[model samples]
Target: MDLSSQNRRQVLQTLGIATGAALLSNTVSAKNAVLKAGPAFKYALNMSTIRGHRLGFIKELEVAAKAGFTSVEIWIDIFQTYLKNGGTTAEAKKIINGLGLTIENAIGFAKWIADDDTTRKAALKQLQTEMDQLAQIDCHRVAAPPFGATGLPLLNLDILADRYHAILKMGEQSGVIPMVEMWGGSENLKTISQVLYVAAASGNKNALVLLDSFHIYKGGSSVESLALVNKNAIKVFHVNDYPAGISPQKISEPDRIYTGDGVTPLKQILQLIKNPDQPVVLSLEVFNESYYKQDALTVAKTGLAKMKAVTAGI
Candidate 1:
């Protein structure tokens, strides 16, 4: 073959290789990029830890925003303070959106399931009102105990599921989801089996199950149970650790610690439920009083870093 013809063939081959390499780079970036837990399922420190000391809602929000959490969980009381302080729901929305953080879920402590008809109806109405605020603030989930007075006896679950469904139906209409938290030391859905039973019985499309590592560990749940849970039904995980001395029989909720500070198998739990299709927000829901005394911003950043490292091995 002539030298010019050979050179032309070589140039064409190099151009084709370059084009393929560019497409592969784009594909990797778009789809299979090591899926860093990113802000998607990244840590969100619950503002409740600093509640009493921080008193004002906006002040606490400032702490979290400055801490760089990119997401957070605000309890009902904090949100009420925001509204009362002339912070309109729209204003709260703006504050969060401007900081590029999302509200993972609102902790509205209401007992939607009760033995009495009156209390139950009242709770549902109250939940609807709360949902209205949650809707305004761009939150999609509300966390609550399984339908009784705060930390009290659960209503007949058979009876409770129907009532819970009413709340779920309300959520469906309003575009919010009721994520029932696994309370650490409660007769109502204390174990994974019980939580599953209640969720299955609800039969509502909007029913969401919230997982908290501290609560799950305190409740004496097995790691294998994590594998069995319906990943789709899980909206978020409150990552924290419980001390070993706490009795499952006791009413005391364990003073939760940071992710790696305790024995919770956070990585194993992650591997069990690492469904790429499902989006999960890992929230730092530590109820520890000690951490509250430290700078809330430092606590938030530290908690996120600990979780990031824990999930790295998985």
Candidate 2:
């Protein structure tokens, strides 16, 4: 081959190598960018944060979506009111999907754990109806707090487990999972220990617990206890903070402040509840009257920002 032909061949080979290297570098950089774009946790807004504004069902959902939240926790009573006022489940599903929001769970006051047989039966019927409605809206979880049994004469744990198992059975039919919830002020199932005990005794693999930071403090359960829980069992966590001075016994629902604004050891608690398989839904649930008095959009935006700030770098 002539000297010029040899030189041309060498030049083309060098250019090819350079182009290949550039392409590989670009691919790696693109992958890293995609990873960074996805957050490690999911954020949600519990309608209770803006419930005081009385935005109603659809409006509250609209405000949440406008604030950049794609997930929400709704109250069953407000939802039923909307239905009574001529809103259908099909319409509710359309509006929610149109807003690009998912109802992660619903808060209901069904007396599923009551000691009275007739009352319990009626409560189960109510839950079945609510579950059917929630299923239609594509919401698969509901809070099963000890509403009626929170008063005197603490119920037996074994019986509570049986009751919870029954509720779970009903949920199976509707494709909805009932999450056993704890109320700090309640007489029964007021602590993480009690909740875990009931869940374990229920002997159902699908039994899950819904926890709240405020309720943990109210019930006098240590945030560190979260480390003992199976992270997968906590599908959705209610995030909030409490001031340093107020005693748990004195603290009320109205005292809940935005995440990271109070004295809750949120960082550690979040780390404890971190699941290796999937991101946990952190739902902001505060009922501060001050927040309720503000513009609903502003409140929703602030709550989302606070949640993001607290979960940043986790």
Candidate 3:
């Protein structure tokens, strides 16, 4: 039917508005679907929890998947050892995908922030190679702890910031992110404040800090300060607890216990670090010798259960 110009214009405008509304509704629905499919926080098993078992790389992944963990954080040395033993990245990726698992992040002791120019250069080269390898397996993040410079005569924070910034730029090229990790036993970057400062001073938008519940206590950092941290700055958080009897100065890696099994204020810390825009990966990391004595699959299942209990209703 023929219509007046004004009627035609009005009809077109109405149709456009309807179409836009439908599109917006669909977008909202898609987002909600994604959120519902995942939990408020993604639970991941850090391979260190079972490293003492000496399970090969593939077996470790299999054990985690059997324990009902779809996300994991692997150690770089173990992964490389698999390669040294004739495992290919393609084969690793196939195995991971087949088991419905994702490598959330990797634990590497790269001395990317060393004070020595030669050491730092070598570390960066090593990291680049590791990043390239990890990317092939769909793993895009690795821990950047103060490995070489974690002893007496602490390194300058400003210098460390620049070094971190350098590796972050390298990460840009490899689609991998190096998360500044705080080590409880390390003399440097052991506190939330120090790590946060390094990340902020990096001047890179992709700067991220990897915090650990055990480290927070071991470093003697106040748990309340976590609220001051920008949620997006933390991508993966190491979830573990420690015995209250051990002082921060005396607490060791082997002292790390499963979440809710010890005295860490996990609920408060989880709430503080929870990202509203995205799911923050809660990786269960521990080094308790007792746990190591147990079967790897049993240990993994127990860790996952403990993590879920602590984060329940958070």
Candidate 4:
């Protein structure tokens, strides 16, 4: 059947439209799959909760795994010490895998926000070292607290953003993401707004923020502020409560209590940050001195139980 030139052009245009529509649908589906939430509550324990027990890296992993925690965060210092004492990442990965647990994130002081140029260089170098170790264990997140900037007046947020982007770009090469965390006592970047701005300003699509309940209350930010954050930007949320009696000014690290023992509005907080498709790690981070006196395994079990109880519904 001979067709007119106009008919041929119309058929070609129709095929192009159909092809474009199919491509759009597939793209949307892949993006949605990445954001689709996992289990309503994914529990993770930060090693700090049992730091006083002085458990080794492998021992701590054992404690978390035996306690039924699917995920755990490690401290950079401990992992470094393990290496200093002749430990290997391959060995660590074997132990972690054998126990059926995943390393969710890590805690490190990068000092990347220092006002001094030389200091900033040192911080990034240290951060890359830590990130390299984390990547070996398949961990892709690290906490970026205001380590050196703490108690100092706010530095220029724009400068901070640029510095953050620098490390984030390095992370791209190292396969890890640095989470700009809030420190309630910090003189800089202590609030959700400040952290979010730095992250957004970095212009990296992988920018993320780490939230801690204690820091939120300590920094004098209301729990409601969490709702303003983009949920995808939160990969790890530190779960701990602070005492009502202690004023924010006087609060210290040792004051952190278990998840439900204190007065933080955790349920409402979770409801705001909880993503249904992507798994948000609820990491237990506490420094209560009393917990250090108990057996490390006991502490791990208790912390995991409390975390589960508070995160019960979603």
Clashes of 4: 5
Off by over 4 Å in 3: 1-38
Q: In candidate 1, what are the lDDT values of residues 110-216, reduced to their tens digit? A: 77866667887788889988899999988988986764743666556666567667788889877788876776566676767667667778888667788777667
Once fitted onto the true fold, the runs of candidate 4 whose alpha carbons sit more than 4 angstroms away are 1-38
Task: Score each candidate by Cα lDDT.
Answer: 0.75, 0.93, 0.92, 0.89
Q: Tens-digit lDDT track for model 2 on 1-314? A: 99999999999999999999999999999998767665557899999999999989999999999999999999999999999999999999999999999999999999999888999999999999999999999999999999998884778899999999999999999999999998989999999999988988999999999999899999999888888788878999999998899998899999999998999999988989988677899999999999988999999999999898998878
lDDT of 4: 0.89
Q: Residue 153, candidate 1: how far off, in angstroms?
A: 5.5
* Model 4: ten consecutive residues of lowest lDDT: 33-42
Ranking by lDDT: 2, 3, 4, 1
Q: How does residue 213 of candidate 2 score in lDDT?
A: 89
Model 2 spans with C-alpha error above 4 angstroms: 1-38
Per residue, candidate 3 scores C-alpha lDDT tens digits across 1-314 of: 45698899899999999999999999999999876765669999999999999998999999999999999999999999999999999999999999999999999988898888898899999999999999999999999999997894777899889999999999999999999998877899989989999999999999999999988888889999999899989889999988778888888899989889888999999999988678999999998899889989999999999899998998
How do all models score by TM-score?
A: 0.83, 0.88, 0.88, 0.87
